[model samples]
Target chain A: MRLRFRPVDTSFYDLFTESAGHLVRGVALLAEMLSDTADHDNVAARMREAEHAADETTHSIVKKVNSTFVTPFDREDIYALGSGLDDIMDSMDEVVDQILVYEVKVLPPELSEQVDVLQRCAELTAAAMPKLQSMKELEEYWIEINRLENQGDKNHRRILAKLFSGEFKAMEVLKLKDIVESLEDAIDGFEKVANIVEQLAVKES
Target chain B: MRLRFRPVDTSFYDLFTESAGHLVRGVALLAEMLSDTADHDNVAARMREAEHAADETTHSIVKKVNSTFVTPFDREDIYALGSGLDDIMDSMDEVVDQILVYEVKVLPPELSEQVDVLQRCAELTAAAMPKLQSMKELEEYWIEINRLENQGDKNHRRILAKLFSGEFKAMEVLKLKDIVESLEDAIDGFEKVANIVEQLAVKES
Candidate 1:
């Protein structure tokens, strides 16, 4: 019997999962931030913690890529995936930070719809990260994320219409619009992460 | 006398310059788009062309990196520079598209201030691309971009203050704020490109 070996860096997958885990934590905090009883300051603090964790994971991936002679996937793809995940976290953090900095006490009820889209995207992304090892069973992840992103766009348009319908005060409309746009950016960031993963899978397979 | 043999690929530098050139065109269209006498439709159409050209140059740089045995800079640096330049173009295009899609006439006069920052950043970026081969004389480029970005931040806050100051109607405030944020994003995108260049220069030096 002969034993064959290849230089496999499984740590990349582990760090990816770690990065996705941070997204889950961040989105959960986002949901809390949107809730009626939510404490904005506390939620923002928790979000900062999650964002810092995500950044650490991203740095870890970059360092690994820098030092590893053989990466699990293409080096560029690894870097993109790390950066994509970090972008998602950063955008989500911005949503929380804005909610606090803007001192927006009353969030539009429609904001929940956007937050729901973010939660679903995070859940799907968390589920998809592990399967990156084989690049199998991942098509549905990005497809669902895309569909959710479109749904988010619709929510955004409808919310903007309601905002401009003269119901919201001028200042409230400005605050609400800022929050809504950040939510849209978070959804878009998730789609970008999924797209990168899909591309990586195709390249690896 | 003996000539040293080295694997030098200058096409990457050429592609970077070409990408920066597209940015020059994009910002010019953006400036035109903001003018009171501007034809938004025509300016947007022209912007789409410039954005497409920038994407092609980015792809060319990526292909060159993948195929070449030795890149002029670190592989990661090449990818970062290509991506950073592309991001600036994308953000600029988004600004133009937002104006067209939102039918936002009557841009705040303060927007020109932001546009000036972008124009300076574009010039600095275009100037810096040709010097990537040596990574010399690049400090002032990023420093100047950083200064402009700070100036942009100040302009952004002033514009937001005016937007929320009850001067504009509710809907106008929302629309104007969206446009302002995109302009800021473009400025931030330029700073990001400059930051990447600074890192690349540090690495090569």
Candidate 2:
């Protein structure tokens, strides 16, 4: 029987999985924030909590990487992945915050489609985090993310065009544009995390 | 006498300097684009050429990093700094393009102040690139950038407030906000480059 001597710190995988878990929760809050009946203050407060939780996960990952002598992957890659996930959360939180602070009462219906894209991305990212151990099946994760990002881009343009299509009042357009861009940034953040995972996997392989 | 054997490739310095030089020219074009009597088409054409030139410099730096082994600093830092500089040019280009494509007339005068900030950052960056070799006097470069970024942030808020102040028509506010945000992004990009330089300096020291 062959024995593995330098056992990779498997906790890193768990931490990453935990990090993605925060994103899943954060995205759910984002979706809730879009509803017409939603309480803006209540949702924003919960989102702040979710964001803080995501930050805790990120800091845990960073602290672990700094203290551990032998990490599962390159320290930089670990840091990038950790913070990349955090950035997505930040973007999501920003979307919710904008919706609240901007006092934007009427959101375009098209924004719901963007939120759907983000939900799918969060789920896919959560699924992919655990598989970092085997470095197996991450290709599809990134490929799908790239695909979703393209979809998000199309949605983004459509949303922008709609905003500029003389549909909404100018003040509303100004407020919603910031929110829409934040949603796009969140999706792009997912793709960035997937790319980091792809790079790490390639180097490991 | 002990002889130094592992000579660092110094061309990276020149390439970075060349990259910053492109930014100086790009910002000049951006300033010209703001002139009311200026021909948008002519200025946009020149800006495109300048952007392409910046891309070439970025590619050269990436190619050189890939081909040459003995880099002066970490390869990743080189990549970050190179792309960081490239990103600023992109933001500047986007501002000019938005002005042209949106056919935006009567740019807010506050925008010129933002451009002044960018011009200073470009010059500071151009001055700081060569100093990477000795890792000396770069603190002021980044410190000034942070200060400038704060100034830019203040300007951004003021601009947004003015846009929402009911002074301009809704359509005009929509168009001008995009341009204003792009200008703010360019300034932020400069700060990002400075941060990379600061990190590289710390690591090398």
State TM-scores per candidate: 0.66, 0.68
Off by over 4 Å in 2: A1-11, A14-69, A74-80, A93-166, A191-205, B1-10, B38-56, B59-68, B136-166, B198-205
lDDT of 1 by residue, B155-199 (tens): 999999999998987687777777788889889989898888888
Displacement of residue A165 (Cα, Å) in model 2 is 5.4
Model 1 stretches astray by more than 4 angstroms = A1-128, A134-162, A165-179, A191-205, B1-10
| Residue-by-residue lDDT tens digits, candidate 1, A10-129 | 588889998999988998898899898998888898889888988989999999999999888888889989999999898889999999999998888888888889889988998899
What DockQ class does candidate 2 belong to? Answer: incorrect
What lDDT tens digits, residue by residue, belong to model 2 across residues A1-205? 9888897654999999999999999999998999999999999999999999999999999999999998889898999999999999999999999988888888888999999999999999999999999999888999899889878976876677677767777678778888999999999999889868865764564
TM-score per model (chain B): 0.93, 0.95
